[model samples]
Target: MRRRFCRPPRLDLPSLFPEGSGEALPAVHKVASLGTPRRVLALLFPRLPVERLRHPGPLAIWAAQGSRRIVLSLSPEAEAAGLEPGQALADAQAILPDIILVPEDPAADVALLDRLALWALRFTPLVGVVGANGLLLDITGVEHLFGGEAALREAVLDRLARMGLSAVAAVAGHAGTALALVRTGWNGLVPTGEEEAAVAPLPLAALNLEPTLMGVLHGLGLRDIGSVAAQPRPGLVRRFGPALARALDEALGRAARPITPIRPPPDMAAAHDFADPVVTREGIEAALDALLVDLCRALREAGRGARRMLLRAHRVDGDVQEIAIGTGLASRDPKHITRLFHEKLERLEPDCGFERIVLEAPRTDPLTGVQEGLGTTGRTERREELAQLLDRLAQRVPVWRLAPRASHWPERAMARVSAFGTVEVPDGWAPRPRPVRLLRRPPILQVMAQVPDGPPFRLRLGRIWHRVLRAEEAERIEPEWWRDTPDRLPRDYYQVELDSGARLWVCRAGPMGPDARWVLHGHLP
Candidate 1:
């Protein structure tokens, strides 16, 4: 009779191999042909250094154990200088001559892991985070869905490799056993009834015990799991503490260990992997349309709307093209997003064909209220018509040309104006009695005749003669004395109407000081 085996609810072993084959398997052979089958994910944070935390800015840093380079998230200058995660400050300086160091952003890493978890859910839901940089997935029952266990493993490895990820994997009866096997360079499946024996030769460090406990184990000459298991349970518990004893028991299958699987979010992201690369605007648009439609359906069914959408186009040459667009309002309208993308598509040049398109909306807001009578000749229609006109004008003229003037200083107000989109003017801003156009720098002038503290008699501005008709003497203003400025000039300003009916705003520089001069500062439109 064949040996009876019990399978738990979450455990499925038939998916791994064919059933009922009564063949004796080798207990512990380091098979050379298959090589080391440790499944490991090396999260290489390319930027981080000890010195970077001093000044806070856009960049972040992180340090990893056993890593030579300091990981930094700075620009090319920082990376080229040899900064990476976990590099010593002095060592980093020697390695990278002039790179700046920054503190690591744990928040960003957590967010990245969240995204990775979402992506990994497509393969298996039994994913768990291993430290800050690695993830563990229990591909038991799910492996068969991809084919046999070997084929599924190969597929996973191949997919990750194609996505430019360096990962290693191992399959075993338990997670701890699998982790130990993978870390110790044992990548294949450990035979039945041999989980304990398989992990026995590995180091105590593989059990993920605390460093203090590991040091104690080392001092006690308990270097490997086999040595630790040889000790009496009560003595082990009393000497090394309960944690180490528990870890040992769990490794030996004397205690049960359970793993909590990572769950995917309610909303789903849809993507497509192309058999061949597509390198045209039309191709990108087509791919985007398909992804948008699928994602929209998912959002609709979930009663959600996306406020921000991110499109990632994977190129054939391994570069990821990311395009992010934020809507003015929360919208579940697929056509609106598609149209916006269509408008953006004209500006993009796909040098090489894309292999995949990933549409992700990690941020979503509830649909507020339905917009009724959208196509009618009301406020919405007027706004749309105005928008179309603005777009046409933007195409002909620069966007900045249509922007409004921004200023707080009444005298120097309206000096520079940007395009409409670039400037965000606040609502309910009442215009002051200031000139519509103000000069950036007031021009110095020579006065023919003038009263000491009154409006000018006759002003000669750049060889042009102007007669003052009605003079309006505005208040005299002084510069902020505390602020050091060698070029700061005291001024007596006058808003005068010219004899020709034009208005000119002028100022007399150095009103009470030496080297005083008259200047035509600005004009009132």
Candidate 2:
């Protein structure tokens, strides 16, 4: 009987932004940000254009509008030559004759921002894109995971710098506060309720206002957020509009906003924390046993099975060891899944004692019921045992694949697949008396025969000759004519005993014609 496995559901992840957005993305207005523990972090990428340059040397990137070209970013050498952002291209060229200028690519920038946001998920699950040049993360209750807020901040900044990004990171109780403070060019944790004072000195342009609105604010001498907030609420609303007031209120922690993370949260997860770290394979297996129990229970209750799952081992010293497993079919069988994990764990390197182990099944699918019979159940159980053994051994050694197909040619009789996938033998209907071990390719040998189609009397293979004590009748196996690479001959296979009592399976490539070739194909032990 053939075995059946379940398949998982599909998912399609989207890109960052649609094309044609040349300038900075407008500040995102939150719709309904989660009201979790307010720890929001804003990560600013100040030298994005300069860092994204394909080559190392000094370079400047600019944005062009017809005949008008303005500098978007400048390298250190260009800066030394008095070329700054917002300078006209004509003036910049006159100042620095040797600088290379690249055009701005909004689509590429958005894609890079999307990838960076995905990378930032290593720190927090609540990462959101901030405008075009920044990312917002809600570290919240997870700060202690990496040794509190300060350590996590340092780790984030250090990693960003190592990735060649010049970034500014600020954490606060509100997303808006973190957004404003990161632009203030400081890297520290601002305590809750200090958002107003923290951002009081930043220029009003930091509000990211429309150019006309910024000019209006400048005309009214409202040069900073502190001065703008000090004005009468109605006057600011009536003159500058509600967007400014809302932005100011959000900046000051007066309004709540929702941050949309790049991807949706994981669907199912099971984790365990140990008081004492685990160091041995036996301990890891025991923990995995308990975790699989919990995970299988959850999947059973939901009527779903995991198609892909990741096991993460968080060591006490801040290093994480992870192993992932995937199946073409969904499975919620704890014993089967645990066996797979055990097979993989043999090669997993753990640098330190692991204090926590978490298993996340990010993808799952429905598993409908299957009927079982007494005789069928017995056969299925045996097949399952055979499958488990094959799976375990395949990890250590390469195994040939034999699928459900039939052919007369010994070498091309069955399908072969990779060692990692399922091992299947074609129907248990192979012809009797065939050699148990067949060579990959039959080797031609010199043979002496008494008659045209008779068995071999003597075989010469390289420097050794084997005298046949007994020879059996030739078994001719024919080839199929419909194959793409059709075999034009029939094989005359024979079983013979040599003078030294060794048994051999030899064949003639075709009928004993004038040009027939004798080949040694297998040995019987």
Candidate 3:
């Protein structure tokens, strides 16, 4: 079954005001500035020569001549002259002797409009994107809050001008009339029934048509909106297709248009603008406390807790100082967040007075209650204390100053491991039953020794002669023959206990060969 939904009544504010005041009302002056003009230049001129340089493109240079900077369409003359919509100054200059500049970044313009739309949310949520650089907001029931439509428009315009943006706005019966009127530099509002009369005089280009389509209409002698509106609907559709017909209907208030708004994330963010810039630590802490309270309230309302908080201090000198802290668990408790900030506050140096402070909770989750009976003097607390102690020891001592010894391989039985705090110790691992005094790297020994497959009776290491009192052969480990290099001859490893209660890890290179040699690798510690 086909279903029908009733259309909501259009928001009308004209009835409440006097006859001349409502429709003939003067538009408030507002401005919307695109901060990143280079981005705009890039979007307009992809092949412009100015992009070849390492620095910023010459937007100001191109915009110097108003006529050269204005373009009617993307023409072959435009392309041949190195004039794309968003070309760089150097590239444009190289191709065309006379060209005007139009900055490129569509994204930045879109962003600015989006921000304006967000601020407009305070007035009305029914706002929609209009073309690439404009926004349409339906301020129906919201006019009363600002005292009237004229007052509301004034407030919006004042806020925009303060932010350094220029905008043309009109309140009319239809979107088409409003757009046409704004382009004609008409500031006053248009009456409900007068939309058709007001829009008829404006050029067909005001319908937001592509350059080609507008050119074709101009060629056909249909120069304005009234000419297009007067044509038969079927004939217009047959000649220009459904797009033109639909656009006509939309402009004449026969069709309804809706808008979507960009909303902030559910996580809370609060900002404080100071009456005067403050550079002291105390001033920053005070601002942080206020923001924290606001953020906590927001999180509580959403039934969530923050796990991480970021504090940003914007100084008057254009420097932005940021500090971040994480709580291992989720918590919306203002005291806890304030305590974390207190610890980090000591590290920040507020060089110049800060004009604004912003607090953001980027990560949050539902909170779970703490467990009971977890005493302050528990094993977990002791472990944490021990870890801290070890961390301190590692920072103070060099990595080469410590060793771990075990009775296993010849050179590896007593490995020389780093003493850094980052090293992981394996669980359930036990040390060998050997003497604690071990050498860092086994010194090479000259042996007037005996036995080919047995322990040596006499040897000299580091100018000290030692005789074997008791020797227990641990076992022989041969190097894999396929993996042996030219310098690495196969050797048999051995663990020998010396006469002075010291155990040594030793290896014989070129094992039992004609060129046999004795070399010590390490000692058991």
Candidate 4:
């Protein structure tokens, strides 16, 4: 017999975050897609520190980390004065005594990066935040949608400039390679399969490795990526370890570095800032008409309809008044949506005066096409009109929806749902002659039955006694065999009319057993 051996499973170690070793980093999503891998575009904003500043001039701004006061980031003017990032505060002041220094705000920098990432979704959905001041996008096949890669890059840069942001973006075959190119000041599109060659000339520092690794690579005379790639893989792994080797492979497009795109941002928004504040309702209504026109135009172009809308009024005294409205379906009709707002405009109170007004659509869906004849009396048109009326009424009072549900018990068959939520059970599950109203809990009643299995001749409701003048044969309801419960075995429901011209729904717990209980469950109109 031949000897048999079993191999042990290999463990894949998690990558460590360079910025902070032990802390949990933001989630990175991977796309497992078919066909050729996606091409990534990395966007970097080197001026995040200066750009987010309220008074960013030719000043030097240094952010603090723990006790170290160093040059966090600087303006181009500060850089021309020989003041650079990571320089000691005392030393930076000694070099440029006139440098206007401010503390760094890492949170604001990250927030602006997030906002810009959301703004970048007009290009492609596959965009991710790289570190604190960068965004990675998987352009893939989406370049031609905006003409071409070069045009797309320029368009993005221009849009950011319009948004008061300065960004440099680079496109490459791989995310790692593209990120490297962006950090090294490489702008424009790098053709597919040329990522290695394009990034080979960049210095090792451009890879953004830890100081110790850079020092070791420098000592070994591996100053550029080309030199590092020439070394034997086994030796590099044995010396610098897996992170360095893996990075090199990723930059060369030999490894997978998938990007997790953020949630897409809402695009429907219109705002007007006023030089003079307006406090009257008439002024606000006039402003609303203008906002609706602008907002509806964008919605039409996108072929999307707003399901939920928000109106924000900024008061002169820093108070913001907001109102929200929802529709039964996605609709971009200006007249209809304006009418809904008109119903509730009286509730809007501008304490001092409104300085700015912004309208936003937070929830939107694809606009559906509906064709109608000249006269709008068609069945579909009537139902649509009814839905609209319900939507209008919903702004004032709650609209309750009732539908049949799946249940063995007669009283449990019907369920109530929200007006805009899911529809009810199928027609086959619905029973006939349902009572107008049903009680939440059935109350037991004392009854005198003249005959067995017959409707009660007289029943007591609370403190009153009523005699049944007319009655019908009891409908027997039984529990489903698969869903048997000892207590909910069977019920005999009867429709009975009292002498006082009132109808009632009563149920016997069992088939007229000696100890059977009678309960008043519902009332009929």
Candidate 5:
């Protein structure tokens, strides 16, 4: 059987965000932002898996199921030849013996869909991937930029045509409404408040129910969405389950679905559009500087500083180039931030010149005003100098700082933290005294102690013996019970001054016994 008669429901749109409350809604249909409905543009690639390869032929992609090979997707030509997906390879060959069959690559198809979704960001930053062959763009406030909804749809469709991909697209007040319309081969704009009238005549296949549920509905002579929605909802939910009712409600705009964007919209961003494409390096830099000035003013007004900023260069040829920079300290200085991107500006490939430049601060930190010290060489000045040095060094290499972690275990005592952030150590929390040179893995040593449970009097290195002139009181160090294995043993560490005047820190594992091991942990300076 072919998918020509089947409409795959909006099954993968995660119903994560619920209405009114924070509690998760049951997995029925994905809904979000209960009040004013937003416009969603659903783009469906009818033959993505085959088109991605760009192989010119009557191609039918197949996958092996046990001993049987079946058609999974077909190229435009194969579909025109009456070859459909789900048909057995042997049967398909009988119809067209010269058909070119390629194995299905679902992973490649998914990756291409993700890339296409990113490319769709040129329309709106809020683009979402639907299943393996579709994309949903939340073009709510973005329609006016490309003239209107109809013009925006044509711009998108025309762009795809140039890219050599066949796509069917629809715009509706609800994502589910848009998705259902496109899957059922219905194209055009379904204006807000008129979703029911537009979706009613579509086939029940647009509801995208389970195959068995579809068969049951077909047996009951309910072929179109209007007939199914006309029946009492309680009776349908009781017999066929809630999925059918939910799908119908979503398509009719009674419910709303949110598009989880591929990239979360930036916290703050500024964009500049040029009347003509900017091809020269100086022109690109000027555009970037203009964007940064606006972006920095916004940051200063919000009392915030950007820790990481991203620059997206939208080329005239429908390609996006991105350049990102991270700071050692959150900053809003336009000139300083511009200097950071000086070395990276050469990396921007101005393919056919860039028509638009967008600068976004994906991450920001609170930068409230603070009182400065009276002296000229104040703490603020010192901090600014330090930040400048770190930022400069970070441009050439990765830079970070060490912060203390609250753990008794030596290995867990420290953590690597962002250099831009402050490390807050709790008051009265003192770190354990550690030797100057501590070994990650302590070396084994043979030791003779005056008492079975006392400190060592003599110790043997690889080929030499050192007599202990004096030994400090043993310090018992226990393993962190919550973190260490149950069978792990405690150690008694001792600082010893040897006959040769060399000081060594040694530890004995567990209680004094034949199995007790002596290890040189570090050299005490």
Candidate 6:
């Protein structure tokens, strides 16, 4: 039996930052001096779902879990009325019967989180999402842009407050230490090399341990981070395994974990903040030109060219419109890149005018200076011009090139691939001549032939009968054994010339018998 499979759907998360120091890491280091201690910020939204609704009265969000409904989040008023998350809904209502209840929307909450992460780009480009309702940012050398570390923390909280969100932010030398401090309602900066002292007094829950492991720790009377750290490493590992010790080490900055940002930082970037919001296309075009000049100059200085460029327009109403373009070849020409983005400028909607515009190239390749022939247009100049033309046409339509694939099956010998990507052809492999055009789906044909595997003498197409004048020797093609099934069979192909001098490509599927099938596979020119 032949088995069929369906292809999986693709995940669309272009904003997801790649793990480790992709191409963006080197640029981040260039902004600050080397050997600088990492400064991380953990921003938490305790009542994210409730705050999203903006309900002034007491409210609680609940969801169905198993056979009963439980509270998931609570507003400040609801919290003051003796309600809490994970509490039974029935019990919560029994305490405050007038409290408003709304169903939980995890998807909406997540979407809002992603939008907030995008908004955070104004503060620093390195923004990462922490679990469900929190964010992590790396502000190692970016604090000076907003005065200092303390001012930056306040600025983040103050801006989120203006947007009607309840945010608690904490900064520390390590990511884990910052997150632990934020959960405890501590909103201050922990100096470098003091992560151990900062997280020592926090509760065991701050470590975010598994419930089972937490239970064992509580049973053993280890209830605080300080107590857990006081124990010897080997003894703790023997009793509670390595996870306990590892978590402690991470919290104390003895170990480190890199933050996976919501968007990959760019290789080179430039931004312009408008004193007054600009609403006209002319203003936007002028700003974009200035930005391109700065970005291209940076690229030239680095001896590199951008392959992918992204433009972000931050509107006054907090919405961001992004336009992206890719080139078939690396380029740093401001005029050329501007032309590519010209067609896409209308896609941005200036709801209340754009407050800031940023341009960055996330993907780049090393490109040395190219010298063209002295007087006339040279091959090198023509090649670069061709790539630019292809890039423009591709913006409006799909463009690709066909490459040869390594397969014996006629239908699987060719593939569509990227125009700029490298193509590999198998070595020392040659195929027999085929038709100029192969049918996408071969149709069955009625034929009359000699007995015991002889070539067909005549074949019928619709109501016309064509007598075969000559038949070439059969070329047998076997199915690829790895993909073979019980129903598949070998094929014998022949190029037969008819009386009218028309050559047809036909194939016989299966062995010689009354059940044998004949298919007109292609038309020969």
Model number with the top TM-score: 6
Give the lDDT ranking, best first: 6, 5, 4, 2, 1, 3
> Which of 1 and 4 is ahead in TM-score?
4
Looking at candidate 4, the ten consecutive residues that score lowest on lDDT are: 1-10
Each candidate's lDDT (Cα)? 0.56, 0.71, 0.55, 0.72, 0.78, 0.81
Over 293-411, each residue of candidate 2 has an lDDT whose tens digit, in order, gives 77777777778878777777766554566787765456787887886787788755566687667666778889656332323476756765665566556546665665545666777
How well is each residue in 1-525 modelled by candidate 3, as lDDT tens digits?
011111112222110111112232221111112231100000012222222121332232234345445332233445554566544455566676554444444465456555555445334434556665566665544354456656666766665555444466676655655655665555655655666777777777667788898899999999988898998999999988999987777566566443343532224456565657877888888788777776776666557778677776655544456788765446676765676677677766667676666676767888544332465556755654554344334333533333444333334444555432233444544555444554565667776545556766777767788876666674555554454455766566566767777767666766554467787766666
Give a tens-digit lDDT track for model 1, residues 265-346: 2233555556667777777777887777767765665576876676666565445566666553455666777765666566
| TM per candidate | 0.50, 0.53, 0.42, 0.54, 0.83, 0.86
**Candidate 6: Cα lDDT at 26:** 24
Q: State residue 243's C-alpha deviation in candidate 6, in Å.
A: 1.7
Q: lDDT score, residue 340, model 3? A: 60
- What lDDT tens digits, residue by residue, belong to model 5 across residues 49-96? 888888897999999999999998888788889988899999889998
lDDT of 4: 0.72
Sorted on TM-score, best first, the list reads 6, 5, 4, 2, 1, 3
**Candidate 2 global CA lDDT score:** 0.71
Give the winner by TM-score: 1 or 6: 6
What tens-digit string does per-residue lDDT give for candidate 4 at 39-127?
A: 67789998887878845456767867678888877887788988888899889999988888888777878877877665554355446
Local distance difference test, candidate 6: 0.81
TM-score of 1: 0.50
The lDDT leader among the candidates is: 6
The TM-score, computed over Cα atoms with residue i paired to residue i, of candidate 4 is 0.54
